[model samples]
Target: MDPQDGYDWQPQQTGYVPPQHRPRAQVPRVDAGRLWAGGAMTALVAALTAVVGLLLIRGVLGIPVFAPEGDGAMGDASTGVLAMGAAFAALVATALLHLLMLATPQPGTFFVWIVTLATAVMVLLPFTTSAPLDARIGSAALYLVIGIAIGSLLSAAGRSATRQDF
Candidate 1:
């Protein structure tokens, strides 16, 4: 070794291969059973979000939940109805995402755009309703929570549901 050279180099064997250059094994995609299970979990999440958000809006925020069509006065919002709506919304989102995954090449991106647009509509719904300002804001906040939960969970679940063959 010459003084100018920092270190000595050893020659590799004729057939030697570098570890980093080796191909990696592919991971198996999630099966349908797992996907459905995830969807069920998403529904549960939506339900819980609805319940908690509604409670916060009505109980903590002191904003009275009311029926939009009926007398525009402070009224009770059925916890059961809220929970059911959230769960149903999540289920529908999941189904739509699944269909998009099966049919489209870029399902995840498309799903995000779709959910975002839907959330925008939900946010705008309060302005159109005749409910009082506080109630409208509260309901819109609830919609935001539900929309976020549905969008994020359904997107992940849909990606998981995608077939490996694709």
Candidate 2:
């Protein structure tokens, strides 16, 4: 006690004090069913995007893509192949997103980067082929559209499927 100020005073105690207990943060949970369902829809959209892009390029624009001009607007079997490939690619991306969500801190950001780089590769792939310049451009544009579709759709799905634990 300080008699002059009429106030109680205490000296600081120094020792090895134990830390206070803290509650651990909960881990975010993911709904696999919802994620997979979104993935399926994304795949369907990707496939359709591929088909429509091909139709627009080949039928409406009269540009040969994935086949010769003599193959007509449908572009032979390659059209179906491209559509299927897009769908498969969507499924694969969805799976990757799922894995990232489970394992990474910012899954969506990583997924976007991965998908964007992959899409860039696909878009540039046509330039490496023996196809004409116009065909390469058209194919590149189509691939870009498909990649955008898949990336966007899957991102939305991932967001919807994630649940924050309080």
Candidate 3:
């Protein structure tokens, strides 16, 4: 009834009450199937790089790259080596890209560019060397084999990583 009572109001005091079980956020689940597909995709990219390398030499450069026409400018052995080496370098680059590109977890622009440049050099290197172009190309193939080995190692590592549950 007093006028002063209307003017004065009191605030309530409360304690924080946390739930017995706090709700947790869900993480986006990654399927194992995608991992296999990713690996295959990477390998295909590498192989295609090798094939394109051969074609570029024949197409863009107008060079008899893979096909052994005559004793090439670099001679047979040297040219073959260069070709194989370039392919190998591409394979290595692909694996490295896949492993190192943690953000993407796949091949990206950097890997492709590096491999492309190396492949081009391998394609063209024999011409400058004393050896024949075929030899250089064959040498390049050898390097490709080495790269394949490196990729195999990386694939195994990827497989192991995927088997782990997040």
How close is every model to the real structure, measured as TM-score?
0.72, 0.85, 0.33
Residue 21 in model 1: lDDT: 39
Worst 10 residues of 1 by lDDT: 66-75
lDDT value for candidate 2? 0.91
Better of 2 and 3 by TM-score: 2
> Which has the higher lDDT value, candidate number 2 or candidate number 3?
2
Each model's C-alpha lDDT? Answer: 0.74, 0.91, 0.48
In model 3, which regions exceed 4 Å deviation? 1-21, 63-166
Task: Give lDDT tens digits, candidate 1, residues 1-166.
Answer: 3244543433363453344434565543546676777888989999989878866766666777644333222234576787888888887887777677667767789889998999889888987978798888888888888899988887777766765542
Model 1 / residue 124 / CA error / Å: 1.0
Give each prediction's root-mean-square deviation over alpha carbons: 9.3, 7.0, 12.0
Candidate 3 lDDT by residue in tens digits, 1-166: 2254433322333332233323554433333455445554555555555555554554445466545545443335644554454445544554565455544544345544555565456546555766565547654653454355435543553544343232
* Model 3 residue 159 distance off true place after TM-score fit, in angstroms: 17
TM-score of 3: 0.33
